[model samples]
Target: MSARVAVLGLGAMGLPMATALARIFDVVAFDIAAERVALAVEAGATGVGTVVEACLGTDVVVVGVRDGAQLDALVLGDGGVADSLPTGAVVVVTSTVGEAAVRAVAEALAARGIRCVDAPVSGGPVRAGTGDLLIMVGADDEALAAARPVLDALSSSLTVVGGIGAGQQLKTVNQLLCGIHTAAASEALALAHRLGLDLDACIEVLSQGAAASFMFADRGPRIAAQLRGETPPLRSRLDVIGKDMGIVGDLARQLKVATPVAAAAEQLYRTVAAAGLDASDDSVVATMLAKEPAW
Candidate 1:
């Protein structure tokens, strides 16, 4: 029989993932917001208005919500999916919540006879749309095997990291590096403009040279747009980066690791949020840097 899958929280990432899974499996898409569910339904997914209804008959349930609190509400609260899921159904948590929260959820689900996997993803919305995203999976061999089809639908690269919470651990490292690299890209481009170098030429040369990164290439044009007072369409928002970086900070503290660079980037994102650009694309950090005197 074909696996019945439910994808919850139909946001930018979740909606595309659900659409991709629907192409290969029988999918029930659920979102708290009616409009998002409606949109997914229009895109050929079976939309369910409630989380309970979505999980009732699914073989695998993917929770793509924002953070730990939202995850808790969907899985443990009144009318939650945890109470409604079939005994052997697997719960795939694709949110980038920290290690502690994921582990706790896994334990809770285990008590109720449901398998939980921490399967946080990366590669941004563009990759998500193309089904070429990377999934960092944290589950045992059996759980990994059980979720392989769903993972195949969402990712071109899937790594089965050790055990419960390992995926979130790796994702914390991902956010730390991404936050720092994004800040570094802004600083580099802003410095080039101040030095009277042709900004586009500088980027063209340097991005082809040893200093290039995914962040520099992807955020460069958006940064340039923000400098011209035209914001690019949001792929990842400043607030989302800030939240992920905050999780990194929390993880670093728990592990007693010093993360000065990540902390600095966190401050920049905090400033971006305070400037009321939280809802803007993350590349707007370049605008914040451009406002400084050319020195």
Candidate 2:
């Protein structure tokens, strides 16, 4: 039998994921933004006004909001999903929230006899639409088994990381690497421009060599466009990476581990965000580098 799934938060990633889930399950999608809810509905999802209403009678509830606080509001606040979920239903928290927050939510849901899975995902909206996201799931054996099919419907790669909070722990590491790599790519491109090299050829050659990275290949064109004053499509925002890296910083502090590269990358992103370019694509950081005063 198909699972009855309720997807909350119909944002860039969530909307596409919910739409995919609707194809195989009875999906009721909800969002704080009515426009997003409307979009999901138009994409064949059933739109609901509230999170609680969406979770009602569902076999699994997917919470894809922005952060820990938003996840708490959806699951533990007044008329939250926990309050509305039928007993034995599973609650999947797919936000890129940190480990501690996932632990707290998992414990709270467990008290109410609702299984909770911290299944944070990688890959952006485009991958989510194609059901090719990388899902790092954190749950016990039974919960993992119960949630596997739902996750399989949305992800091309699903890894069952140990227990509660493991998925988020892994995602934190992923964000750290992402921040560092993006910063490195930005710096390399800026240096290439400053050296009076042909920017396109420089990128093409570097991308074919040992210096190449996913961030370089994916964001290189966008970085070049920012240098040329053309805004690229919004894929990943500077503020979003800043937020993720900030979470990584917090995790590092809690674990007493020093992440110097991630710290430097975080500062660059914070600078971009503070300069009122938070909503711009992360490649815009190259613009900041290009405008720096000569020292």
Candidate 3:
């Protein structure tokens, strides 16, 4: 029989991920939002009202929380799912919470004879629904084996980074580049708009040339659309990227690394958040930057 899976926290990423896993496994989904749970059921997965209910008989639990605090609250201490999960069941963390946080959770889960797979994923909602994400994993052989089927169903590229916490470490590195690229893309596109050039043509050219980056390719059109005063759907929110940038900063400080560029990007995200755009799509940064005197 296929490994029974439970997906927790069905937000933007979690919902699509649940849908993808449902295609291959007996997926049970849970979220705080009733609407989200209903949507998961519509996507061919059983919907549970609570984390405990979702993980009761599941072999693997996939968590997609917003940050370390949520992840901790959901799986550790009193009334957490760790107490409810079966011994030897694996918990795959797909959030980009920090290394230390994941390590703490892993250690806690290990004490219960449960396994934790630190697998932070990249790629947006569309890629997630298609099972084409890039997953960075940090776990021992046994734990990895326990979660391999779920991870494989969710990822097109899965790289084993190291022991527990390494996935979060590498994901921090990945977010550093992503955060910086997003800031740079906004700045460059804002400049292009100011230069009286064809923004679409410029984006097309830059995306094909030395200036090319995945952020530019993925978020570029959205940036251009924002320039046209159109509201792009909130695929990735400003606060989400801002939160990742904050994680990058925290990790850099712990390592005592000087990341002036990433720091700058982090500040840019802060500015956008301060402008009350935290709930908006991150592409709105391009719009905010293209304004007069560019904050």
Best by lDDT: 3
**Native-vs-model 2 lDDT?**
0.87
Ranking by lDDT: 3, 2, 1
- For each candidate in turn, the TM-score is 0.93, 0.93, 0.96
Deviating ranges (above 4 Å) for candidate 1: 194-200, 293-295
Model 1, 97-189: lDDT tens per residue? 888888888888888899998999998777876788899999987777888888988999999878998999998898899999999999988
**Compared with the true structure, what per-residue lDDT tens digits does model 2 show for residues 11-108?**
76899999888788888999989998989888888998987789878988888887888888888999998799988889888889888888998898
Task: Name the weakest run of 10 consecutive residues (lDDT summed) in model 1.
Answer: 191-200
**In terms of lDDT, which candidate is stronger, 1 or 3?**
3
Task: Name the runs in model 2 displaced over 4 angstroms.
Answer: 195-198, 292-295
The per-prediction tally of clashing pairs is 0, 0, 0
